[model samples]
Target: MSDVETPETAEKEELLTEAEKKALIALRRDEAAALRRWWQRLTLTPHELEKLTKQRSLPRGVRAVLRRCDSAEAAMLTQGFRELWAMLPESTKQTDYRDEQLQVWSCIALVAAELRKEESGVSLAKRLGQQKEQTGKPLMSELRFQQLLSCRTPEEFIQRLRRALALADKKGVSVVLLASVIALWWREHRGRLSAKPTQRLGFVLANDYFAATSGYSHRKD
Candidate 1:
């Protein structure tokens, strides 16, 4: 049998000083680009856009609010609608949201709520129940749209992310995957921010911090 590259073997491969296997932890510019673009097609089919892109306009009031702020995260929340809609149970798609923003944000919220499950070891239902208690109903409620829209300021945004990660189940979200999304999002909106040296996010800090002490284990040089 071939030795498939599970996380165990992959980490072992990273410890080896080989040029070809560096992509397991490449964390470089091109590698970061590869990571982010991977999410544009979470379902990975070209023919399904009709179902994904059919909704042309959000309700009038909802459109006005989303137009004001321009952040990479927001754009991802918007473009990610396709992936979100596809992943949902077909039975739930019939849910009648109270307003257009509520409908749109539902897709985004499902993704955000993922953070709560991915970052922790709790069960999915319990975490969601706690969230529901705060609103005095379930997450499916259109009024709970505020839970998703609460990220108006930096503090609230951080809390929203923190809550999702802190509360969700152990197998919840993929860290490497989210890292890739942010990596791509930054590239699209980087022009608005001040220029700086090239950067990589998510998994690089430890690799970078250990370079000197651990003898540059990930580099071929």
Candidate 2:
């Protein structure tokens, strides 16, 4: 093999790179769609959903760890974590993203415990913006939303996300959308430096929130 790349070799390499990028994109799309379907199935099956959400059905120890554990590692040790992981799509079970997946699972488990029911077909951020007080203000204030976006570490993100999920549950937001967004957020946050700036989770959320709130405000006016 030559030490230096020839022009023909370089062109072939670039084409291969493009093909790999397309394959990766397709894989991600399939994974996301699979996850959404999994959530939909869980929501449709009350008995199954109850096993994860109801305190009486879910073991006390597992529930406690999920609700209060300071780290994903601690949560992963519990039976609830394993059960939750088992319920996830196979495409999401890759060991390469083990830590990130565990954190996402932890958040999903916590939110599921609080979820009264699924409000499918709505984005989480839009649901938050749609929740209004008697005085016509968004239930999730801009400051709180900023706090969520500003979290610097996994611990901080988990803590703030717990509060946000609680609010979403109370406001009747879609748990399916909520979980999916949380997973997307973790993926984006972890690979943020390598990801295009325009494709950020924060940007997606901010746009959805503001657009919904703006529409709500106009309707109220």
Candidate 3:
């Protein structure tokens, strides 16, 4: 039994890593053109650009993909990415690009743009909640959102994420996944203020997209 358990665990871990790698590879292949264009347009340092393209910085779509990323985390990242996409200048849009793929790449660019903004560890989760309220989007209750937002650091962030995942169950709003979403949100949005990086509205909009497709639910705080 012990031997079986060890191998099973290892296999599961391996599968998880593979899933993550596949997601990143897909983003890179599909978004390569946009990534490069954004890199040049944004004047990103090579290192900065690398972080922006990191899988953790992109959106999570589909069930299999979300499982690999932790659903709650993915949700938070989606919110941030969604907000950025909505704020980007019209020049970034390409008529030839597939709509879904274009939105994904736009998130990547938005992350880089956010990182380029003024560096301050703001309450990103809170900001998302606020944006949701302002936009009149159906979000997880404000109380729950605030509870999640109370997480200040990455470690605390993950803990809250786990809770959100548990409450969300497997339906699509897993707490850890939401945490990833928030991290991805932060990854893309934390930066200097001078660049006027697009607002968090894109991430917010993305959340709307997911709510419609994924059956996501939220209540007031």
Residue range 46-96, candidate 1, lDDT tens digits: 454224332222223332232332432453344344334343333335545
For model 1, the stretches where C-alpha displacement exceeds 4 angstroms are: 1-153, 181-221
Which candidate wins on TM-score? 2
**For residues 1-221, what per-residue lDDT tens digits would candidate 2 score against the true structure?**
11111123333233222322332221243333333333433333546644433312333354555556666666676665565566455667877877667777766666554454555455567767764655567758999988877777667777776676567664455544565566666666676442555446677578778887886677746
TM-score of each candidate structure, all chains considered together = 0.23, 0.66, 0.28
Q: Name the TM-score of candidate 3.
A: 0.28
User: Please, what is the whole-model Cα lDDT of each candidate in the order they appear?
Assistant: 0.32, 0.56, 0.35
Clash totals for all models, in order?
8, 0, 50
Q: List ranges where model 2 is wrong by over 4 Å.
A: 1-65, 169-171, 193-198, 219-221
Q: TM-score of model 1 relative to the true fold?
A: 0.23
